[model samples]
Target: MVSAWETWVRRLVTRRPGVPAPAVAEATDPAGTRLVGAPEPVSRLLVVRPDTVALLTAAGTDPQLRRPGDLLVPPLLSPGAPPVTARAVSTAAVDLDVTVTDLLTFDGHAVDRAVLGVLVQLDDRDWYAELLELAAGHADDLEEYLLAAVHRELTTAVRGAVRMNRLADLQRLTLAAVLQDRWLPARLGAGTLRCLRTRVQRVRWPGEDEPTVPVRPPPAPAAPEPPPQPTGPDQSVPAGST
Candidate 1:
């Protein structure tokens, strides 16, 4: 009988004929080769060095980058490898030491602020709509307020007209007072007659003469000039005296 260890070893070694061999594992350096000599405490803005030209050239020629603004997620380089390749573009190259972290931070902040502003504006509009709806819902309150305002204005106007003596006795009726009494005509009979009398007094026939007041007659025309004082010389004896 086969031993357990032997059976296990046989099973591990056996393979299907059509199957391919497993891929070999390789050691990798995370830090790019070009940045191996880069200074510690890396700055936000790092200038491209001349030595990384080969890396940048390779990146520019990458087949995967077919469009503008496309980004290489993880750089295509090993530890100590230069990242010049990743920054290459068709028009102009980025010459700074911007890391993925920096890019994320910048984009995140901008997106957050824009989203927040839009949300705030929407919230304000919603609040305004709600307020309008509430006002509409309580229409009775609004009507009361409007009616009070109108009444107050009418009262003030009536008082002012009366004080200024600009109102006829009939016109002086206060709307508020009339409303309080259900708008009944004050003098269904006598008051109506008085109103009719007032109306009649205001009427006048076309071309009717108005009462005329005495006007002083214009001064009589000045006496006609004395027949031109004998034109040539002053014949009057007074001329010699003067």
Candidate 2:
């Protein structure tokens, strides 16, 4: 079973000698760049490394990748074009989609609920709830399933909050998402700072104490105009006079 993946990796390495290899090969080619530093290679098998999974995700969608049996490879860059550099990409920025057929092709790695959920959440894609339920029932790593669900909720809330311009909600959602990251629990608190900074910067607020407009006393109510004295024949005579 393992031999199949090793064979595929070797084929990919041979197919594109200088192209960035996606996974750490069990055997290294003297000519190829190391896998750890370059673009992640896609595979018919599930990739367990979260970072590698993330890199493949950042590549957006390729029509070839969506085909059931198509071998995954790094995108061929245009002449003088640069490859993507962002680590954590927002799905909104890309026009990518994954079909259920493509997803079910994961073979033994199909139980990776985290990767599955990512396929669903990114680019507003959704899997039938029954599909996820089925996956969860058989998933080898239940923790990854739950974590994926958490991240999906976070992305949904964050996007919704941003759309509505709800800063407080956005802050709450971002903090909740950060807390879900077990690797850096401190980021939960720090995440708030980042959220506030981003919000202020996004709206172009220059200072913490800056007012929306110059504060000044409101104009006093104008004194009521004095009643007009009688004019001509309409003038009232002196009280004692006729």
Candidate 3:
């Protein structure tokens, strides 16, 4: 196999204004800059926006590094440029669709039909740490990482509630009632993702246009079984004599 990374010096990747402002973004096209601080030979550099932080895996020694005001010597990790992870201090809204199922009952209820709409906010403070935890030392992709975690949390909460109660209760239950005080402030690893808005978007029951079919009305009540019963006994005996 052939290698493409030529390790000679360090580089920087900065988030300029007016670009796609994702909370955490990969620095694919890093901009080259003068060695900011220590003469550490890094494969690449990521200079994030104000109030934003970048995780430079292939650079400087101090683990408690904050910014480039003090550029120290960077370690030389040679083969290729390690991908830089940077996140601006901001919040992002993520919408999740979680399937609510009746776990305790074998009611043949749909496992996929009923869904709860979960609107969560990934704030500036917590998202990065949570991302790092979920990444588990792997490459970083914020959207992919976040949604997976959220979906898991939502499913757990919903199913837990469903197990205690019937699906019928869920049909009438409102997402707002559960979300604000109950499901909000979810702690996933070190990340804090809160439920911003939620709703029970779908249920397995019939819709307005397709309501419960009415029973056939007991065949119109048999047309008044009236006073004929009073004389019917004698009338039948007389017929036999004739």
Local accuracy of candidate 1 as per-residue lDDT tens digits, 1-242? 65574354323222113212111111222322211121111112233323221012132332221123222332343455344322211111111111011101111221010000000010113322332343233322322222232223323432332233322322344322322333222211111111110011121212335558989999999998878655777667865585
List, residue by residue over 1-242, the lDDT tens digit for candidate 3: 21221111101111122323332224322322111111122334434433333334333321222332223223344345343323332244444555554434224343334466655554445434554454344223333334445555665665555445444554556433544446544554236455666677665553324346787655555676566545444545555585
Q: lDDT for model 2, on a 0 to 1 scale?
A: 0.28
The residue ranges of model 1 lying beyond 4 angstroms of the native Cα positions read 1-140, 166-242
Number of clashing residue pairs, candidate 1: 13
Candidate 2, residue 49: Cα displacement in angstroms equals 30
Q: Name the regions of candidate 3 deviating beyond 4 angstroms.
A: 1-47, 50-53, 59-90, 95-111, 123-136, 174-185, 188-192, 206-242
Estimate every model's Cα lDDT from 0 to 1: 0.24, 0.28, 0.41
Worst 10 residues of 1 by lDDT: 113-122
For model 3 the local lDDT of residue 107 reads 41
What are the per-model numbers of colliding residue pairs? 13, 2, 10
Q: Per-residue error at 154 for model 2, in Å? A: 1.5
For model 2, residues 1-242, the per-residue Cα lDDT tens digits are 33564444333222213533233222223433222223234332322322222222322332111211223333343343323221111111111111111111112112111111111122212422332342224223222233333333433433332344343433445523432333222211112101111111112111234247867999999999999986776576879996
